[model samples]
Target: MPQLAEKVPPSVAGAVLRAVFALPDPVRRLIAGRAVVRDGQRLALDAQLLLLMTRLEGASLTGATVPEARQGLARGQRYINRLPERPVRTRDLAAADGIPARLYEPKGLAEGSPLLVFFHGGGWVIGDIESHDSVCRYLAVNAEVRVLSVDYRLAPEHRFPAAADDALAAYAWAVENAAALGASPEAVAVGGDSAGGNLAAVVGAFADRRPDFALLFYPATDMSVRRRSRELFADGFYLTDADMVWFSDHYCPDVERRTDPKASPLLADDLSGFPATYLVTAGFDPLRDEGEAFGERLREAGVRVAVRRQEDLIHGFANMWGLGGRFQEALAEAAGALRTGLL
Candidate 1:
């Protein structure tokens, strides 16, 4: 590990710390107070937990059914609707196998504009193009690039390989129809957060030709539930252990499929021939160690890799960019990485 810095800039570090601490005590208490119980024994996720989760994530759940999960995801979409509008031209493009995407093209683009196909994060269960609109908007406006935000199918309703297939299809479409979108086929990149990031990595690994760069934000690289970090930072860190368990159960009900490389990229035996990678990790996130470890593996495989650890930040900080003060700093860092990698 690199030598630790004594202190980081307060504007970034302090703000993140305050945000994590400012979460409702009841929610924190629930996470901290949780205990492992036998499987199939019902645990009440009552109104209090639901309300707390709703407040924190802008998701709502009346019950644990798939329909309720979709409703909760819609609530998150509504919450992200507050960002200021920028000039972006929207289009419905046909991707691989007729999988469609809502592409956002920033105004005032020259020919051969760089393109970024973004996948939204929601543990592959919740979230869509609408849920991640703000993030795509920010990237398109600030980075001055065209962004193709995909609405890939979610899990439990559409499981493992389905999402990966959609991601690959999207990439193929971007490559074939780059000119129609006013982008350079060669300059196109792939990126996302959480489950989306996992998809991005998987697609990069499997694409017949790789993207120019890969951007991963707090990606869940490993699906194994046994990591030490999973146990250590599993609570009071925004993305709780219970929440991950719920997401995993919904994503992969069949335990045997957890080892599938498409489901868990960290378990893949080979890491060669993928695009150069920029991986960002939140220090307090349960997925942090695995993301960092994946970056290391990429470097070991002779792929160019840059890893940034936002030590004071928690999981899902990217989605909180519009609301959190420290988000600009993080975004700036990400933009810098993209510029270096893409240019």
Candidate 2:
């Protein structure tokens, strides 16, 4: 059964949200309280209002059971993610090792369009294809490429390395079957947000057959370290420290194993041959510093890297397209990067 929040109809929720956000900027700012300034970045007004609304609703992922957390995220996605009704065709497919996957192909794409193998973010524990359906759709239509959204196995049930293994397998499957999917075999990219971003980076770092490009959105690179951003945005920033502990506990229970390169790809020895990459980090996200550090490491290793810091956004802004503010703007830049990189 779904939670009470999940019971709210998406239409009703959407209407309420649209009305609330339609409030004047000054009113919204007043309601959201004073400006949140940290690390020399002011949180965007829209993001501030969203955070305030989330808190007002008393919703949180920190203390929920696994099922409850998943339900909460499902409800949130339903409320905030507006699916694009563009002429993209979707088909269910099985990825490598029979993992469930969905392919999003925009209408009238060229025979050799690029394909992005995307993993949905949920700390490797909660998220699935449905939670990120709109993200793939937006990317497909805007980037003018097909997207393979991989439903990778989650944590507690699958544990450390399972999600990474599945991500690599799914990406490999996309690369191998690109032509069949009407995608160019040589132009497959790997991407994801948050935990999905971590998995994408892992695939880029360790896969036998390299991806042509990598699009990472605030990936959790060095899971073993407690970085400055983690301390700065540890609480009230959507992804709290308690939430991280919960996710890490479920995904990688063995403290000793957290340092493994496959588990913490930032610790990987060689990032030399990684494909051209665009890594985006949220200014207010706990993972921001580490993600930027990974981009620096990639650059140092001779990988072509572009790192964009959406300083006004939060960790999960990639899924906030329904809000139609800075979230959509940030995503549009990312899509443009993908289109250019794959060309």
Top candidate (TM-score):
2
TM-score of each: 0.80, 0.97
Reference-based lDDT, each prediction: 0.74, 0.90
- Please give, for residues 212-234, the per-residue lDDT of candidate 2 as tens digits: 99999999998799999889999
Q: How many residue pairs collide in each prediction?
A: 0, 0
Q: What is the lDDT of residue 168 in candidate 1?
A: 88
Best by lDDT: 2
Worst 10 residues of 1 by lDDT: 38-47
What lDDT is obtained when candidate 1 is compared to the true structure? 0.74
Candidate 2 wrong stretches, greater than 4 Å: 1-7
